[model samples]
Every structure is written in structure tokens, then in C-alpha cells.
Target: MEGFLIRAVVVGIGLWLASQIVPGVEFRSTESLIAAALLLGIVNAFVRPVLIILTLPIALVTLGFFLLVINGLMIELVAWFLKGFVVAGFWPAFFAAIVVGLTSWVMSGWIGGPPKGRIDVVTMRQTGPGRWE
Candidate 1:
């Protein structure tokens, strides 16, 4: 779908930004960066939820902070599987994940997807209990 490709491109940009900003995160080329983004998306979609459930107790104990560790680990896992992507250590992955998440959040706004920027608007409606009309 068009939406999916847009999200992937946004994620690729995020990965590129992460590689630039995080000292120990590296992508061999633009192709690798895009592939890393796709791999990250697949890992997040398929593996992250299982990992979260397995680590639920730790997540609860840490007030959800453990999720950040999980995110970094996912990035490391992707780097492990992808030859051209390299993450030097946990800290680098952690920082890179944060940058990637931030970039994705910002870019999602322009992409018109579920993660788009939120705006609240108030409207007046004629009284018809529990109805807009």
C-alpha cells in the first residue's frame, strides 16, 4: 500500500539520521540504510511484541523503561542479521534508537499516517442526546 511505503521511507530517513548522529551506528550505504529500516520495521512488527510480553514483569518493575532497552536490543539484532549495518554496542544502539524514534515521530506528521501530529478542535452541536446532529 502507499501508506506502507511512505512509512518505510520515513523510517529510512530516521535510520540515516541515526547513523549520522550516533557515533557507533553505521550503515555501509543508502541501500543498507533503507534495508535496515525495512528490517527494523519487520522486527518491530513481528518480534517486539513477543519480547515485550516475555519481559512484562521487568517492564512493570521498571515503570516501562525496559522498553527502551528492548528497542535497542531490536536494533542490535537487526544489525546482527544485516551485513552492511553495524551497531558497535548497547549504548550506541540505545542512542540511535532514540534518534530514530524521534525522527519517525516528527516525520509521521507529514506522512498523514496513524502517527500524524494531533490537534484538538472543539465544535458545537445541536442537542440530540449522545448524537452530533
Candidate 2:
């Protein structure tokens, strides 16, 4: 769908930004960068949920801070399967995750714009004195 492609592109931009901002995150080639972005989307869609469920207790005890670790793990997972997408260590992945998440959030708002064909409004008419229809 169109939404999915837009999200993927946003993620790609985020990954690119991460590589630039995070010292230890690197992509050897553009193709690898693109692939890593798409793969990260896929991993987040599928693997992340399961991991969240499995780590619920730890995540709760940590007051959701462990979600950051989960995000870093996802980045590391992508790096493991992806050639030329190098994450130097857990710290690098953690920082990269933060960068990518922030980039995606900002870009999504700019690129996505307002929602299409939808509006939030309320209207009311007086029927009988203070009684509304």
C-alpha cells in the first residue's frame, strides 16, 4: 500500500541520518543502506512484537526504558543479517536506534502531512430549548 512505502522511505531516511550522526553506524554502499532500512522495517513489524511480549516483565520493571534496548537489538539484528551495514557494538546500536527513531518521527510528520479524507469536528443544534437532537 501507499502508506507502507511512505513509512519505508521515512525509515530509510532515518537510517541514513543515523549513519551520519552515529560514529559507529556505517553503511558501505547505498544499496546496503536501502536494504537495511527495509529489513529494519520488516524486523520491527514481526520480531519486535514477539520480543516485547517475551520481555514484558523486564520492560515493565524498567519503566519502559528496556524498550530502548529492544530497539537497539532490532538494529543489531538488521546489522547481523545485512552486509555492509556495520554496527560497532551495543552502544552504537543504541545510539543509532535513538537517531533513527527521532528521524523517522520528524520525517513522518513532514512527509505524511495531515490525514486524508478525515476530520475531527463536533456539531450540535438546539432542537427544543436546551434539548439537543
Give the top-scoring candidate (lDDT): 2
- lDDT of each model, Cα atoms only? 0.88, 0.90
lDDT value, candidate 1, whole model: 0.88
Question: In model 1, which regions exceed 4 Å deviation?
Answer: 115-133
What residue pairs are clashing in model 1? none
Cα-based RMSD of candidate 2: 3.1
After the best TM-score superposition of candidate 1, give how far the Cα of residue 36 lies from its true spot, in angstroms: 0.6
TM-score of 2: 0.82
**Cα miss at 45, model 2 (Å)?**
0.7
Tens-place lDDT per residue, model 1, 11-73, is 788888888989999989878888888888889889999999999999999999899899999
TM-score of 1: 0.80
Taking all chains together, each candidate's TM-score versus the true structure is 0.80, 0.82
Ten residues in a row with the worst lDDT in model 1? 108-117
